[model samples]
Target: MEKKPFFQGLTKKTIALALAVILWAFTNFELDVERDVRIPLHLSGLPEDLIIVNNAPENVDLSLRGARNLLSSFAFSNKSIPVDLQKTERGVLKIDLKRAASQIVPRGIDIVAARPSKLSLNIDMLVTKRFKVKPVLGEPDSGYEISKKLKIVPQFVKVKGPASQLGKLESIETAKIKLEGEKAEFTAPVQLQLPSQYMEVLEGDHVNVTVYIKEIILSKEFRDVDIVPRNFGELEYTTTPELKATLVFNGPYKTINDLTSNDVKVFIDGAEMGESRVKRLRVKVQYPNSDLLKLTKTSPTSVRVRVKPPPPEESPET
Candidate 1:
């Protein structure tokens, strides 16, 4: 094997050239540089009753000046600017972005400028209010109806929001409830529909709603209902012009629609009437299913009745 020298192919001029290039690169790397860093904007120290509104900036763009090496490392670090609102009042608030960012930057880095030098915020006081919960209901089945007033478990709800918006809110409604083809009573848990995007429900966001449903009540009129006499045995009793009645009944839709004159009776009682030249008696009505049907009205409320003694039949029979 041939012996090789440690300084083989080396020269004094080559050494000087390498040293010059190294120094130039080190100087350039250490030179001051400018860059734009995008960092999050943090809001802190706000009073519990106060809130910032109206499109506040969420992140800030900082124009930072530092050494080339330092700027590169800082871009990856966790950097943010926090704005203190402890003493803020309800109104428009303005803050300087450069001044806010300078507090968090590294000691050697300078925040020369910011994209948005000034920030504007709309501040408002927070308020909580209780409002009635309105239920949004849909139509029921074709032959059904709402039987009575609706029942809500919790009639009122509390909402928190900016005072400017909450002042205009009068009530809150539940998410729409579909009752189409619903025939029976039911209970449901429904969420609330907020009127404003900034409002939040406190304690609970939903309520229990109870709905009542029943068959619809319908009215039907029956014409020419015969009026009969009762308890007039062995006596001739005639109504002065043969009275007939018009009867109106109210019941469930199915029962009322299927009703006929045979289902109802109109009569006059002779036992209740006293002996007089011309007896005036009030008409009465009888229904088999009293629990389901009701008589609402009857025409010819009263009728004149004449009673005659039975013809002399005792002599002929003897």
Candidate 2:
């Protein structure tokens, strides 16, 4: 009785320690703790032909309550709440967050509340359209002009976006490419201007633009070109000073250099001066390939012409 076995004492102490641990665990499990956690909001079951045009919530604020011990060891990483839209149509969709909280929260945690009880989403039908790519270029250097039409590789782009927005879009423009003080032909890689955050160029985001520039040459002048009368009926017409003028025109070097007075016709319309003896008429210029040349100047813009009835035909052998 006076001396106890060492092994017996050790056994009793172990039992007591075991009991204490069990009691501590029981108490901790009964106590509740609250925590506010941020969980990512995931979208699911969206139709392939639909898109969300409006900004949707990225994360949800969740208030969770659970046993103290469970709360202490809880991890919030990679947890998400999903909003299903499989059967949702194009319109404003209101989602009840409370209903979805149970599906995402950890097993032991209870959802106390969600900051936003409801979420509103704006959905639209997705569509694709072809849009012409327009190059945005700054003014070229002085005395220079764009000689030929700009050439864009992949002139058209396929764009995808919400149907409502895509319907209004006709063309996409490239970012401003500065041609100020630029001369000669050059190419540049430029990004397309996006219509909105919801719209994207499905083909590509960038394009290569080839610009053709040429120095503006001085206009070539053809002097002493004869002016003729046209649309004359049974009348004779004559102009003062024999109706001659100088013509000035600008065009490609080859085209303008090869042009001659015979290639151009300066005329006055006789029909426009009906029954008038003396009339002032405007001079008009014409050429076989008129589109190639730009008329810059003309001397004697108007001509004074005298119109008279043709002399009575001489009676033959009465």
Candidate 3:
């Protein structure tokens, strides 16, 4: 009986040893390293879409926790299986639990939790477009009109969002100013919108828009626009006094360009301009400033002012 008991004990020990060895082998067989890796998968080159969301998806959150080894071997794809479009409607997007490609797929992972589980994807057909963000002005003070150069900053911007949503956005407008004859720098915080839908402005939203107004000079009437003379003294000529000079003046276009030979009256110290031949002056009219209407012309060239006294009275009746 003692011997039988001994044999039974041996069998029990063998069973226990075998169980321990099997457990040890299993424990040491594989690397038990797990990691939360972000993997990207292709969205099956279905058409190009540019729809951005205000929030992140849930499945995207859940798929992050995965085994490092498996994730390392996963493939990255921008395109994948065609998503289920049957239930897809405007402002709705449902993530394909199975179809969507991911960079990492855990070898033996059970999805603990999924975000946007059935992503009610507001299926926005995405589109990126370039637009001109121009400024609009309100009625200016009486007699003062707005200029074309009054454009806003960020002259151009890129817009992105659902196709239907983006298509509706035609133009963006800023605050209006009642320009009251002043050089003022104006700024405003503005919002963007479409015909009926709102815009997800990718580049611009609240920007510092500026408006500048130039004061116009209406009461500044012009006169004959005198010709300031040149002083050359103590130089004598044999036959006649030669006073060669150039004339420069600034005035209105009509008065300058319309100047004919009859308009010019030249005389030395207010004399009858004896033998003074008035050459046809060439006038070049120019707008002096971006603000004022003060035009100036340097002439086609310098006007040669010659002073030759009366031709010796022709030696009459000798």
lDDT of each: 0.84, 0.85, 0.46
> What is candidate 3's TM-score against the reference?
0.33
- Sorting all predicted structures by TM-score, with the top scorer first, yields 1, 2, 3
- How far is each candidate from the true structure, as Cα RMSD in Å? 6.2, 13.6, 14.7
What TM-score, computed on C-alpha atoms, does each candidate reach?
0.64, 0.59, 0.33
What C-alpha root-mean-square deviation, in Å, does candidate 2 show against the real structure? 13.6
Clashing pairs in 1: none
| Model 1: ten consecutive residues of lowest lDDT | 1-10
Tens-place lDDT per residue, model 3, 208-298, is 5566543333423234333333232432323223333233443333344444434443323323223345432333232233233333323
Q: Per-residue CA lDDT of candidate 2, range 1-318, in tens?
A: 566676668978999999999999886786577889888888999999999888877888988888877877766776788888899899989888977867866678898898788888889999999999999989988667898999898899999999999898779999998988777999989999987999988977999999999877656899999888788766776778668888899886557777888889998888889678998899999975677788988888988878766678888996
Q: Arrange candidates by lDDT, highest first: which order?
A: 2, 1, 3
Screening candidate 2 with a backbone cut-off below 3 angstroms (N, C-alpha, C), the clashing residue pairs are none
* Model 1, residue 130: C-alpha shift (Å): 2.8
